[model samples]
Target chain A: MKHRTFFWFFLPTGLAMFLFIALPIVSVVTQSVFAPHEAVLKTVENCTPLVGCTTETTIDQEATREIREAQPLGRFVGLDIYLDRGHLAIAELGEAWDTAETWGDFWDRLFNLPLYRALAFTLTFTFIVTPMLIVVGLMIALAVNSLHRHLKGLMIFFSLLPMIVTPLIGSLILFWMVDSRGIIGSALVGLAGDPNFSLKASTGLTWVMLIVYGIWHSAPFAFVVFYAGLQTLPKDQIEAAQIDGATRWQQIKYVVVPHLMPLVTFVALIQLMDNFRVFEPVVGFNASAHATSLSWIIFNDLGGETRQLSAASATSVLTIIGVAILLSPVLVRTWRDFKGK
Target chain B: MASKAQRRPLGLSILIYGFVGLWFILAAFPFFWTLWGSFKVELDFFSIANWTNAITGERTKATYDSAFTGAAYHGAWVQEEFWRNVINTFMVCFFVVLTSLTIGTLGGYALSRSGYRYTFWLLITALIFRAMPPITLVAGYLLPFFEWNVWGILPTTIIVLVAINQPFTLWMLHSFFQNIPKELDESAKVDGCTQFQAFRHVIVPVMWPGVITTGLFSFLLAYNDFAVTAMLLSESNRTMVPAIAAFLGTTYTEGNVMFAVAAVVSATAPLFILVMFFQRQIVSGLTAGAVKG
Candidate 1:
């Protein structure tokens, strides 16, 4: 009777995921195969428009002055800023700059430019941060856990502050700190007695700062999860290891780490999924000649002409594939490992 | 006690702690910078700047005054893009929450508690949504949805946002429902409570934390989003993040203080309120699968 009554459970949630999530993902594959440059061009040529062409976002002259003046290079162009658009030649921003022309060539560059670079950066970032978080979180958890059983209920609540701080805001806060002229940077400059000092002047240094910022905003979750996972572990396993004269390192490596593999895998997977979604920081950073990520690159494509969306969508579809191909192994391993348990 | 304390390199611990502590300060500074910037005027930002030759420091309070006024010199936020975004945000939040909760709770209870029909298909459905990149999905069909709308871009954006959010809320709710034991519900029904009554009295009480977490997450997703909103929304319906982003290299020339201030205030409000208040409930269960614990 219970099972019979509950039969309708899947429809609402199932249908929603189908119509929205699954359908869009499938759309990516279909669109990629079908949305060749020529096809997209033809579609744009035929379609009327998403919005009326008469509409324009005309900025007030005074405000526009401040905006134009803010640019390090006088003024950066608007949506039509894509160098290869129509007949404009992109003055290569640097020799390091990768170039793409036409929608197809651009598609190649999409993969070549930031896709893998961002992917690698994201992966490395995750690899380093997740472990750090777990360690820090575990230590905090142990300290909190050992004090008293009554502390468990309260400490558990206290440990969740970072979850409430959206990653977007977290990233932004980091951005301002290491910002070229931000207070910390200013202090560093003052110490050096060099007014023009900027942390971003050193390329490697800049990346380190970015990674450091990522970990700061993210570590709390790792700590809390390890803390909770710590609670679930039996006291006897560690006690037995200690009694047997196992070093603390041996106990953690065998007893603790083995117990934590599932949780560690879960944390790594979630962070990996989110790491690619790195738009907030890259966007918020608001410094440097260029700061592009896989997500930001795709986002930039959409803001161009309405016709560019198909091309943008194509890149997005490819990105989705890229992620699937990359994460498939890790995901499968996680599933298999969990199933083995 | 002294030997124990002196066993390891004391200096290394200090170095590690210092690095971590400094990182936390850096991680959390932009928010405070925004808070400080929000209280000041545009002129003040220019004069008392972070740098003399640096671009970020050059942006003034005037940029902000113009953003709210949209008049460059004087107007109202109500007449500006900011007010409309707030309206759009509120409407989107209200509808998304109400609809998604109803669907997720009902669906979750049935999926978790009962061996119901088509459960396989439903689980697949949830997984599929969980899998896709949101920005891409929304961008692909912006035209299709836009054509179907009448109120310029507002209606189209609202619909798409709601659609993007439904899956996760449902998934989270399902997990919430599953965590409770079947005995709790059976016992309640045995005591003369109906199915709905058991859910309302017994299950709902136990699972309120999950519901709140799901709601808060969805709301944040809706609120903090920039890429999807930028892709789907037209200028008039532009949300605050994109608007500030646009302002970065546009309206105020390169005056970032406008963006600096607005980004800080608009983005931090909900997060600050939620984290500082229901900090535990926010993290407790919703992210359980994602985190180790």
Candidate 2:
């Protein structure tokens, strides 16, 4: 296609992305630097016939409103917002380091910061779920590959349910079943021989439930990709290995896994990005008390009567940075592929 | 020679089948259990007293003179007025898909056909945009939308969603367009046709499969989104996901958890039908990236 033709063809989508996607990123970065304006203060002195003179400092609400209205993005605070207790918490980090007597205590104090706490959970969820899903998906794909042809369609039809459902609804379904009064929770109580036992009451159990939810929701994507990879496995290679006295396990270890390596990497990259933004499950499971992610923190900030836009913007910048870091490997690979082509 | 001997050992086959059976139950049993529980009264569905009450609808029978009850669904659909939100969701989904696909197709096709290095950079840019969480973009939009007084309406949300949907739509359709041999359009150009004429007469006819696949994905992205719709929409114009979330927030403290449960099931019912009808397209769309990459 000619340059003019290409330009016209690409103009509409390009303009939409520039206006919405590119511009918002710039806006978020710009907003993060500016904190909301402070209230204007004034001092007033009053002398009354019956009382001594008194002076007081009060907020000039009218002046403050005018100032804020004039500059709605608030005053530029540079990196002040980023270093506050709600975010990087630089001062809190220093205080914790100064007070701690040992490494474990220092680590505990570090995780106490809200930002660090959220980062810990987000990274833990991402790393744990990605690899576990790959292994579980491979096992499922291998087993299903060996099944009778008729069962394949039925298995796939059922397998897509958890993945295709809305993330909130999927998590809600699991949440209800595991509530203290629900069947699974009740069964657990019976098994433990204690009626007071509840899954909701513990931090560790809730994390486990959330991780299980993550694995349940995402494993099907891996399974489908790996299953497709399994179809093109070389029959002659497997037969040759078998003729050379290789057992089934050995053949699979040598042949099947290597063939699926690219698909494995594909699943890993996609899952890492997906799991980093884990937010809906937190809402659906009501696990925010026990678990919080960066996305969840941003959502919490934007919500309620306060609508803390600056705070949310700071966290948004940090999240975009985190995603960019996770995305670098894929970007590098794409660049290399493009150059090679 | 080794066909018979190559068969798995009987014990091994049994273990594989056992594992598969277990996974099948784990993958699918949650929906079935929830669908069953949604019908019974709250006490019987939860059943803190007797576990069998959940399966037998023991409390539902005592109150309503029937083992099954439609009270939860009635409460969710009628009393809660969740139908309004459902209509809003479809409205948002319809416009987002239409606008995203309309532009995404043109841009993706252009990028694929153009033999220039700039196409590479554009795709990389789209990838970066696609990777950023939509919630992050919400923070950027809040101030402007608040200032302009356009934050809480359906059209603003629709346009925002279309933009959010653009990156992935472009990426998916770009790959799909690449799969269509370039010769189809080139041949038309060799005749007495301009570039647009070739795209209209020659390329469009053969492009439905790829476009449909990409469109299916765009619909899923718009439908499954929570962050954009939840934050951008007002209380009166909320989509189904946000509405269900609202039900949870309000109903949980009110001792009406079943309202949220019913709403969740109602929200999932459309997705169930979608999967039933378009399973192939979804699967193909999913593996399209993995297989090509």
**Winner by DockQ:** 2
Query: For model 2, how does the per-residue alpha-carbon lDDT over A1-341 read when each residue is reduced to its tens digit?
Result: 88999999999999999989899989999999999999999999988888888999999999999999999889999999999999999999999889999999998998888899999999999999999999999999999988988998888888899898999899999888888788788889889898899877788888888899999999999999999889988899988888898888898899999989999998998899899999999999999888999999999999989999899999999999999999998888888988798
Residue-by-residue lDDT tens digits, candidate 1, A42-82: 11223347854453344466555555445312222232222
Q: What's the number of clashes in each of the models? A: 19, 0
lDDT of 1 at A239: 73
lDDT of each: 0.59, 0.90
Residue pairs of candidate 2 with colliding backbone atoms: none
DockQ for the candidates, in order: 0.29, 0.86
| Residue-by-residue lDDT tens digits, candidate 1, B1-293 | 33342243666456545544443444344555656545444543333254431233234324543322223212224323466666776776666676677677877787677664455446545554555567768655654454556424655565566677776776677677777888999999999997878888988777777888887777777777777777777777776666656655564465545444555466567667667676666656545655423
> What is residue A248's positional error in candidate 1, in angstroms?
5.1
Model 2, C-alpha of A60: deviation from truth (Å): 0.8
Worst 10 residues of 2 chain B by lDDT: B1-10
